[model samples]
Target: MSSTPSASLFKPLQEGDPGDVGGYRLAAVLGTGGMGKVYLSYTPGGRPIALKVIRPEFSEDPEFRRRFKQEVQAAQRVQGLYTAPVIDFDTDGAQPWLATAYVPGPSLAHAVAQHGGLPLRSVLLLTVGVAEALTVIHGAGIVHRDLKPANVLLASDGPRVIDFGIARAADTTALTGTGVSVGTPAFMAPEQASAGTVTPATDVFALGQIAAFAAIGSPAYGEGSSHAVLYRIVHEDPDLSRLPTELLPMVTRCLSREPADRPSLTEIIGLCHELSPTALHQGEDWLPQTVADSITERLRLPGPARTPQPMPTVAPTPTEVSPSTPPPGTVDPYAPTGLATPSAPGAPGPVRPRAPEPPAPGHHTATPGYPANHTPPPVTHQPSAPQVRQKSRRTGLIVAASVVGTLVVLGVIGSLLSDGGGKEENKGAGAPATSSGPTGGDGGAGAGQQRKDPKPVSYQGIDLTDGYQLMLADNPPRPVQSEDAAYDGGDLYFKVVNFLDESSIGTDNGKLVLLDNARKGSLETCRTETRYTEKIDLDQLTQGSQICVLSDAGHVAVATYRGRSSESDPGSYVTLDLQIWRNAQETDGN
Candidate 1:
C-alpha cells in the first residue's frame, strides 16, 4: 500500500517517480484506493494528468481486467463540461493504468472534514456540479456505481466526479453477481441491496447521502456499521427534517428507494438552481422546466396544490399646473425681435410688447413696453412710385434666381432616384427567375449559385421523428420538404443559426445551441437561450462528412458521419431523419 497524505494536502506531480505510465510520468501519490493508487503525473510535453495503477492482485484477475476495459469504454462515452475527462489508458500493459485529465481540488470528504461540513451556498454548488456530471454520464448510457463524498472533488471552478472503476454500462448486460452489492455499501440505495439493478436513480440516492452530509455533517442513514446502515437505508425513512426547506424536495427526491420514483439528473439540475446559491449565480435555475412535464408525464405523481398570489400594479401620477399661464410658445433668438398687435378699426390702436419674459409657475407678466389690456396708436403713411417700383424690381430678380437654383437641385435628385430605383427593380427581377430556373442549370447559374451561398430559407424547428435527428451527422442538410422526409428511429432536432459575421459556421466553425427561454405558464419557463459548442475533430471533418444535432430542449445531441463532399465547395449536409416516440417528444412548443 502507498503512504497516505494529509486530507487537506494538494500538490503538483514531479518527475522521475515512476518515470512513466500511460504516457504520464509519476510525480506524487495523490490518493490510494482499495484496489488501485492515483498519482499526479505529467505528459512528456509537460501536460498535467492523473495516472492510476491497478493493484497487483486485482490485475492478476482476467475478469477484473475485462471489466476495467469495459469501464474505460463506458467512460469514453461521457462528454460533459463538469466531468473530468479520461485522457489515455493502457489496460493491456503489465501494470494496467488509466490516465484522466488532472483536476485540481480537494475531495468532498476531505473538504468537508477539513473545513467542517459546508455552508448552504457550497452545498448548493456541489449539488449542481455533481448533478450536471450525472446528467452527462446518464446521457451517454452509463451508470456511476459509487457516488459518495469521497468520490466527489471540490475544485476552484466547481465540483467533479472521479472513480469510474465500478461504473456499469446501462443496457441489458448484467455485470455483477446476484444479491451482492458492487458499490460502496454506505452510499448504496435500498434496491441495490435487495435485488435492485443499477440505474441513474441509484446514483440519485447516493447524491442524497452526500448532500445530507454537506448540510448536517452526517449521512441521512446515520453513522453505523456498513450492514446496519444498509439495513436502515432499505427500511427506514430518510430523516430530511433537518435539511433546509429549499433543499428538502431535492434530498427527498434523491433518497427515494424506488428507482422510478426518483427525479432525473435534468430535473435535479433545475432543483439545484432553485435551492443552491451556486446554480442561481450560474443562472441555470430554469433547466428544470424542460423536463418537468416529462417527469410529471412519466411518473404521474400528484403533488400538493399551491395558491397563486395576485400581482401588484402601481400607477404613475401626473404633475399639476396652474391657470393664468401663457400658452406654450417658442422663442427663437434668430427671428425679428419685435412684437406688435393690430389696431382695432375705428376704436383702438396697436399694442407693442418688449422682449417676452419667462413665466412664473402659475402666472405670466407682460413685458416693460407692452400694454396688457389696451391698444397702441396707429400710423398711416404712403410711399412714392419710385420706391415701390424699385422694390418690385428687386423682388422679381430674387424670385428668378431662387427658381433657377431649385430646378438644378431637383433635376439632380430625380436622376439619382431613378438610378437607385432601376437598380432595385433589376435586383428584384433576378431572385424569382433564379429560384424558378430549371433544376438542370448545369450547376453553374442556379444550383451552383445556391451551393455557393446555401442561404438558409428558415429554421425548420428540430426534427425528432423516430430519433432520426439524433443520427444526423455534423453537416446535416436543411430538411427538404419534397425529398426523403422518411424518418428512422433515433432522430433529434437542434436550433442552429448563421451568425455568419460573428461565427465561422460557413468558413471556420459550426455552432450548436440549447435554449432556456424561462419559466412560463403552469410549468417552468426557460431562463435564457444559450449555445454550448466544442471544437470538431479536424480528421472527422476532412475524411468524412459530419453534422452536429441537439434535441429541442438541449438535453441530448449526437454526432454522425454524413459523407464526403463530391463538389468543390466544402459544404456538408446533416440530416435529421430518425423517428422518435413519447419521452423524446419535448419539442419547442411544449
Candidate 2:
C-alpha cells in the first residue's frame, strides 16, 4: 500500500455519497466518474479498501444492471500480480456496489503530474506489471476498454490496474456501441475509435498509450477535445518523438493501427526485459527517486489514517433476515427480460383475446419463491369505493325484480281463492317445484354453478413460465383500444420507467418498485392495447403491492408477487403473479 497519508489520499465525504453502502462505512471520496463514485472504506478487520457505488440512474437501467451483474460475477476468477481484484459485490441491491482491496498509492496520472515522466527503469517495470494484469483480465474472457494513466496505480509495491473487466467487446461495435465502452479518447486504440472488433489486442493498444504517457509525461496523441484526440488516434500517427530511443520500437509495435499487427502481452513483456533491467519486484524501490522518497516519507508519519468501523448491527449482511417475517408472497427481484418485453416504438398493440380461465387461488406456480411445500397465498388489493358502489347497484336491481315476482304470485293465489278454489289451470301454471337434483329447475342453473367468485377489483396475478423461457427486453407504454374502455384508459396503460428494488425487501435503499403491466409477453405474443403501470413502495406496503395493468378489452390485469419457489439460486430471470379483472370499473376516473 502507498504510504500516502489519508489526508492526501482521500477527500471529505460529500452530500451525495452515502454514509454507508452495503456493509461498508464510507469514509472519504477516492475518485468520481460519470458512471460511479469510488469511496475509501475499511473492513471489519480494519483493512482499508475502495468501494465503488454505481450512480442511481445507471442502477435503474435494467439492461445496464444485468450486464454489470454478469461482469462482476466473471471478475471473481481474476487474481493477478498487478491488479486490484474485486472482493465482493451486491447484484440485488438498489445501488449496485463492488469492493476491491485498497492499494495505497497515487494514480499514474497524479504520479506523472507530480514527479514528471517516469524514469526509463520505472517505465519498463510499470509496463510489465500492467501487461501481466491484462493477461489475467483476458483469461477471464474480459477486455479492459479503458486503460490510461488514471487507471494505473503506482503502488509502493508495484503498479496495480484498477477498474478492470467492466466493459464488453461488441456493440453495433467498434467499441462505442456496447454502452460498456467508456474509453478515453487519447488512449483509445484506432479500432476502438472506429468501433472495430475489441479483443485482448485492444487492451495491448491501451497499454502502449499508457507507456507513452508515462515516458513523456503527456499523451502520445497530444492534447485536445475528445473528438480531436480521437480523430488524431485514427487518422494520424502517434507523436512518439518524446519517447526515449531504447523503448521506441516495442511501444511503437503496440500502437499498430491494425489489432492483428499489435504485439501480444507476452511479447510486450519480453521486449520490456530486452530494453530495460527487470530487477524490480514487490517492495523494491522502482519509482523515480523523488516519487519513492515522497511515498517513503509518509510511512514514518502517524495520524488517524483509517476510518472507524460501523457497529455490528448497522448494515446487516445478506445472509441475515429481519426480525418480522415479510408477509408471505414477498418474491424475488424483478427480472427485466422475462415475458415483459417492451414493444417497438409506435407499433400498434395487438387485439385483446378472451382471457383464459385462471386457476383457483392457493395453486402455486413456478416463480422465484419458497419451496413448493410452502406455497404462499396470492396478494389481494383492497376493494375500492367504486367497486362497492357497483356491488350495491347490482344488489338493488336483483331486489327490485324479486319484489315484483313475489307480488304477482300473491295475486294469482288471491284469484284462485276468489274463484272458490276451483281454478285448477292457474294452480298448475304457478306450481312450486321439488328439488330432484339441484335448485333452478333440476340443474337448469344451481347455486354452485353460478360464478360466486367475487370480482377481483385487485389481486395478485402470476406468470408461471419457467425461468429459462426467453422474453422481450423492453416495451413502451400504449393506449387501450376498447371502444367501451374508460375515458382515461390510456392512463391505465402506464409504462413503468423505473421500479423500486423488490429483492427481498426491507432495505433502506428500495422503498418503491415501478412495474410495466401493459407491455407483456415474448417477441411473438404481446398484450399490447393496455395502459397501466404501477409504482409501489416496498416499505410502505403492509401487504403485497398491487400492479394494475389495463387490458385492451375494457379490463384490468392485476398482479402481486409472493415468496420464491425455491431458495436455491432462483434461476436466471424473475417471476410475477398476474390476474386479469374483466369489465374493470374501479380505476375509471384514472
Candidate 3:
C-alpha cells in the first residue's frame, strides 16, 4: 500500500517568494479548483508554464493522490501536439505540484461570451480543430469524460483540447458501480450520465452538442436546472431548428439518443474537414452567442486582463412573401424553395397580379361568372341601327356554333380534358387542334399537351398554413402518394409543417429532403421516398391545394412555388416551400 503523505514538509525552496520551483519561477495565479491552485510560471529561459499545487485535504487521500500521479503519467503519454506537455512533477513533496507547458489563450467558453455568437464559417473552424484534438486524445486510449467549453482552449496555433485530469484510460479496471454520474452535467452524454460505458460515440455526441452551441448560440437542449438539462439530454429531442440549413442534418445525426446512432470521431473530423480548412485553426469562428457571452462574462470575472469588448448584434432580414405568378419575360417565378427565411416581420407583401390562366382544365372561366351582354360603349354614338343589328347577328352565330361543337366533342374526351380544350379555342374563335401522341404511361392526356415551359402551379391560398407555390413542366401526372412511384415533370407535391413536426413524419427512422432549385436533376427525374404518421397530416385527397406525396413507410414531400413583385421592379422569383421525409414517426413522441 502507498504511504499516507505529509502536508507541511512541502516548504518554499526560496525564502522571499519561493519565486522558482524546479528552476521555474511562479508568475501569477491562473485559477483554483477542488484539487489545487494553478499558477502561471516561467523557466530561466523565459518559457511559460502552468504549475498546479495540490490542496492539503486532497493530499491526505492516498488513493486520490495515487490517481493524481497516474493522471500525470497518463497525460505524459498523450503525444498529440494540441495537448499541453507535462514537463515535470514532484509527488513526494508535502504539497505536490506539477508543471505543464503554459498554453496561453482563452477558453472556448470565454470566446463565445465576448462574441455574440460564432458565424457559420468560424463554427466550421472550431469544429475541425476540436474534432482533430478529440481524435488525438482518444487515440492515446483516454476517454475525456469531461469535454465541455471550459476544457477547450483557443490558442494562437489552433484549438487545443486540455484538462485530462479526470480522463479515464480505456482497458483499465472499473472500480465504481455503473450509472455513477461524473463530469459537467451540461456536456455529458446520456450514457455518461447513467455511468454507462464510454466510447468514441460519447465524444461524438459531446462534439455534436458543442457544434450546436456554436451554431445557435445555445445548447440544443435549452437552459434549465442541472437535473432538467441532464434529463432532457437523456430523453428529449434536440431542437436543431436554429442550426444553419447546410449543417442541421449532420448535427441532428450526432445528437441521436442511441449511442450507435452517433457518428465516430473520424467521421466527425471528416465532416469538419468538409466544412472548412480554416476551421482546423485555433480560433473557432463559429462561436455561439451563449458561448461567446459565457466566455466574455468569465473573462470579466476578476482576471488580470481587462474585460474584452462585446460583439455587435445584427438583425436578419425577413423572408419575402411569395406572389402568384412571375412577371413577364422571366423563365419561372418561384425558383428558390426551401431557403432559410429571415426573421423580419412587416415585410412588404408581393404585389404582382396573377398570371392569365393557361388553356387547361380547371382554368377559372370568365363566362361562368360574367354576362356577355355587358358591352363597351362606342367612342362615338352611332346613329345607324343596321350596324348594331349586324354585330348582334354575328355574335349569335359564333355563340351557337361553339355550343354545338363542345357538345359533340364532350362524349369523345373526359370532362377534365374538355374543360381545358374549351379554353384553348372559345366560341368559334377557331377549332383547338387536339394532338395525338404517346404519353409517358400516365393515364391523363394533359401529359403530352404541355407547353415547352409550362406555367407555374398555384396553391389554393390556404392562409396561415405553411403552403407554397410550385413549378413543374406539364409533361405527365406525377405520382403524389404511393409506396414506390416515380415523379414526373409536371406534378407538384406539397405539405405544411413546423420545424419539429417536419423533423418527425414517420417512425423516428426517417429522413427529410426539401427540394428546391438547389437540386440538380430535372423535377421529373427526382425520385425519393418518405414516411408518414397520423399527426403528420399527409392527406392525399386534397386537390392542387396542398398536394402531399406520401409513402407507406411514412415518408412525405411537398412542393410549392412563390414569387415577388414591386411597383419599381417586376421583383424576384423563387420556390417558397418543398419538403420530403422518410419514415420518422417515432420521433414525434419525444
The per-model lDDT (C-alpha) reads 0.49, 0.57, 0.49
Q: After superposition, how far is residue 544 of candidate 3 from its true place, in Å?
A: 78
TM-scores vs. true structure, each candidate: 0.45, 0.51, 0.43
Q: How do the residues 489-526 of candidate 2 rate in per-residue lDDT, one tens digit apiece? A: 22232111126424222111111223444434221111
Instruction: Estimate, for each residue in 260-299, the C-alpha lDDT of model 1 and write its tens digit.
Output: 8888877887887776544355332322232222222212
Badly placed stretches (over 4 Å) of model 3 are 1-23, 165-182, 277-590
Number of the top lDDT candidate: 2
Ranking by lDDT: 2, 1, 3
Better of 1 and 3 by TM-score: 1
- RMSD, one per candidate, in order: 29.7, 21.1, 30.1
Give the poorly placed runs of model 1, Cα more than 4 Å off. Answer: 1-17, 165-182, 276-279, 282-590
Residue lDDT tens for model 3, 413-529? 775575575455443556454543221122233533622222233322111111211122211111122122222221233333445433112212223233334443222322332
Q: What would the TM-score be for candidate 2 when compared with the true structure?
A: 0.51
Give the Å error, residue 124, model 3.
1.3
